[model samples]
Target: MIVDHRIYTCHPGKLAAFVKLYEEAAWPLQQKYLKNCLGWFTTTEGELNTVVHLWGYDSLADRDAKRGAMAADPAWGEYLAKSASMGLLQKQENRICKPAPHYEAYTKAKG
Candidate 1:
């Protein structure tokens, strides 16, 4: 499996607006296309206005195909435009990860 971790740093004091827009608009659309969202969170500690999301995919090809489809959707475009107009985001970063061999076993045991 592959995990995609996305971090968004919102403009100072704009995190709430960003989160609201995302929940009301983008989240639904993303749920339709990317079905394996692991978690969505916001930092309350070290990085104050940062939002983080994790998505799991069966493989890189799966992630690409799913994301490409989402990008082509007209509703997704509209959401992007609306979010951009808000000027809430300051920076964005994405990282793709692979689990260590023992990770699955560790999680199962923890569960």
Candidate 2:
């Protein structure tokens, strides 16, 4: 399986608001399309205004299809517009990860 790990950096003191927006707007949409979110996180010490989200997919094709569905949704478009208008996001970094052999996530995918 592959993990779509995303890191979103928000403007100073805007992380809470950004998270709230996601909760109110995008969270349900994600559940409908990308059903396997491993975790959503906010840092305590190292990175101050960043949110990390991990999504698990069976393969790249799975990720692509799910993300395409989400991207096509009108609700998703609305959320993006809201976020852009608010200027809550500063940067976005994404990493597509493959679990190494013997890892729990990898093993589960095999099973």
Candidate 3:
């Protein structure tokens, strides 16, 4: 199993706007195409204005296929355009991870 972890740093006070837009537009689209979302989060103390979300996939190939389908959707394109136009985010980071031995069972169940 694999995990796609993403962090988005919003521009100063624009965190609320970014989160709102993402939930209203992008989240639905992602949920529709990528079925194994693990969770979504925001910082409470350190790294303020950053959002984090996790998605589980069966493998790298599965991740790529699901993401490709999402990218091909017109709604996803529109959401990207809207987010870019607002300039709500300052930076974004994504990481692909695999579970450690102890967590493998949990990942297998989730994935």
Candidate 4:
């Protein structure tokens, strides 16, 4: 599986607002188009005003296709517009990862 991790550093004092907007507006849109999305979360400590999200997909192509669909969705467009107004993220970073051998076994057992 492919794991997409996004780290976002928001402007100071905007963490709560960012989380609220994500949960109430952005998350639903993400769920609609990116079915492989595993989870979304924010940092409570260590890195203040940081948001982290993970998406699991069968392959790189699958991830790309899902994101493409999301971009094409009108609801997603509206969600982005609303969420963007919430706050400015100082920096955004994305990483793609593959599970370790142990993780594969762990995931299968969970399933």
Candidate 3: regions farther than 4 A off: 105-111
- Per-residue lDDT of candidate 4, residues 17-105 (tens digit): 77877788778878887876777778888988899999988999998998998899887787778767654677899999999999999
**Is candidate 2 or 3 superior in TM-score?**
2
The count of residue-pair clashes in candidate 1 stands at 0
Clash-forming residue pairs, model 3: none
What's the number of clashes in each of the models?
0, 0, 0, 0
Candidate 2 lDDT over residue span 3-106, tens digit each:
99999999999999999999999999999999999999998989899999999999999999999999999999999999999999999999999877779666
Can you list the residue pairs that collide in candidate 4?
A: none
The lDDT of model 4 is 0.84
Q: lDDT per residue, candidate 1, 1-111, as tens digits?
A: 889999999999999999999999999989999999999999999988999999999899999999999999999999999999999999999999988879977866888
Residue range with the least summed lDDT across 10 consecutive positions in model 3: 102-111
For model 3, what is the error of residue 42's alpha carbon versus the real structure, in angstroms, after optimal superposition?
1.2
Ranking by lDDT: 2, 1, 3, 4
lDDT of 3 by residue, 1-111 (tens): 889999999999999999899999999989899989899998988999999999999999999999999999999999999999999999999999988987887756777
Query: How far is 97's C-alpha from truth in model 3 (Å)?
Result: 0.6
How accurate locally, in lDDT, is each candidate?
0.95, 0.95, 0.93, 0.84
